[model samples]
Target: MHELAITQSIVEAVTQRLPDAQVTRVCLVIGKLSGVSVPSVEFCFGPTTEGTALAGAELQVEQTGGRVRCRHCGDEFPCDDLLAVCACGSVELEVIAGQELLIRSVEVRNHV
Candidate 1:
């Protein structure tokens, strides 16, 4: 699955950021409407991190609510649909959340 590739990328990124450090845990902010499945990502984490600095690291995911901004009412509200419309009967909407896949923090141990 693509989650494996994504997890691999995350491990690579963490390693690059802390070349000499050993990753203890990775904190990710995943949006509800981000089109990413939590179980899928978790399933790939272990395999993807194998042989990497974060091999035994813990993967922590935080779920965030999805939001959309209405163009007509200039209001913001929760949105579950990717193409969620505004309550003001406007189809023009800007996604404010639930479409993010970001590493919020990485805990690492000093390389002694």
Candidate 2:
């Protein structure tokens, strides 16, 4: 699954940035429309992070709902999917949220 590759990238990025840090947790923000599977990412996290600074780190995730702004009617509303139509019968929706894949935080311990 692509989540394996994504997980690898996350580990690599974190370790590269904080080579000396003792990482205890990694907080992620995955959007509902991001096309990334949370379960698959969880499965890959351990394997991808093995031997890295992120090894043994907890993977904490926060999910966001999809929101769109109707281009034709200027209406802001919640959208569940790409094909969602606005109440104004407009298909011209500009995605304002819920397409994010972010690393919000990395909790680490100070060197003793």
Candidate 3:
């Protein structure tokens, strides 16, 4: 699965940002439309983080619903599906969020 690659990337990025620190936890903001599976990420995290600073790090995920802004009426609403349509019967919808895969924070212990 691509989650392996994604997890590896996460570990690399976090370690690069906090070099010499041991990562204790990782908080991620995942959106409904992000197309990334939480279970898959969780499954791949340990293996991907092996032998790295992120080893044994706990993953905390915060899932967000899909939010879209209607271009025709400038209305913002939560969409359950990716139909790209607004409730006002407009096909012009701009995704304001819900496709995000962001690292909110990282808890790390400083190296001696």
Candidate 4:
């Protein structure tokens, strides 16, 4: 799965940023429309982080709902599916939210 590679990259980046720091948690924000599998990413996390700074780190995923702005009606509303349309029955829309894939935060332990 692509999540293996993705998880590996995430681990590498966190390790690079923190160096010897021990990562405690990783919070990931995922959009509902992004088509990424949260379970898949979680499955790959442990293996990808093996022996790295992120090893044993808690993986937190926040899923965001899809949102789109209706171009014809000038209304912004929650969109839960790909076939989004405005109340005016116009297919033209501008996405105002969702469709995001990002690492929101990384928590690490403080060295005494």
Candidate 5:
């Protein structure tokens, strides 16, 4: 799964930042339109970190609301359940959120 690759990248990045530290948790901000499933990520994290310092580490995903701006009305509103539509009944819209995929933060314990 792609989540495995994503997790591998996270492990690589964390290790790079703290070579002698043990990762305790990973906080990820995943938008609804990011196309990455939280369950899938969690499912792959265990296997991906099996032999890495992140083994047994917790993976936390924070979901954010999707937002879209109406090009015709210039109004911004939640678009979680809508399809590029504005409250003013305009179809011309641009997605402003719900497509983010990034690591927010990593918690680690330094090795003495």
Candidate 6:
């Protein structure tokens, strides 16, 4: 699954950032509309980090809801899914947030 690949990439990036550090936790910001499977990422984390500095590291995922601003009525509201629209029956909308997949931060201990 792509989660494996994504997890591997995340591990690599974090390891490169902290070459001699022992990773403790990775905090990720996942948008609800981003289509990323949180469970799959968690499943792949252990395997991808095995034998690496990030071994035994914890994965923390923060999910954000979808939001859109209506162009017609200038109203902002939360959307249940990726379909960006407003209740005012307006198809034109500008997304304010919730379409992001970002690595927010990492907690690590320096190797002694």
Model 4 scores worst on lDDT over the 10 consecutive residues at 1-10
**lDDT by residue for model 1 (1-112), tens:** 7777888888888988888788899999989888888899999999888888898999999988899888788999998787766666898888887888999999988656
Question: Which digits, one per residue and each the tens of the lDDT, describe model 3 over residues 25-93?
Answer: 999998988889989998998888889989999999998999888989999988757876777799888
Best by lDDT: 2
Task: Write down the RMSD of candidate 3 (Cα, Å).
Answer: 1.8
Name the regions of candidate 1 deviating beyond 4 angstroms. Answer: none
The digit string of per-residue lDDT tens for model 5 on 1-112 reads 7877887887788878877778899998988877777898888888888878888889999988888889998898887754555768899878889988888998887656
The clash numbers for all candidates, in the given order, read 0, 0, 0, 0, 0, 0
Q: Which residue window of length 10 is worst by lDDT in model 1?
A: 79-88
Q: What is the lDDT of candidate 1?
A: 0.87
Q: In candidate 3, which residue pairs clash?
A: none
66-105 in candidate 2: lDDT tens per residue?
9999999999988768888888898999999999998999
Score candidate 4 by lDDT.
0.88
Best by TM-score: 2
Measured with C-alpha atoms, the lDDT of residue 85 in candidate 2 is 86
Per residue, candidate 6 scores C-alpha lDDT tens digits across 1-112 of 8878888999999999898888999999988877778899999999899999999999999999888888899999897575656778888887788888889999988556
The alpha-carbon lDDT assigned to residue 92 of candidate 4 equals 93
Error of 6 at 66 (Å): 1.6
How high is the CA lDDT of each candidate model? 0.87, 0.90, 0.88, 0.88, 0.82, 0.87
For lDDT, candidate 2 versus 5, the one ahead is 2
What does each candidate score in C-alpha RMSD?
1.8, 1.1, 1.8, 1.5, 1.9, 1.8
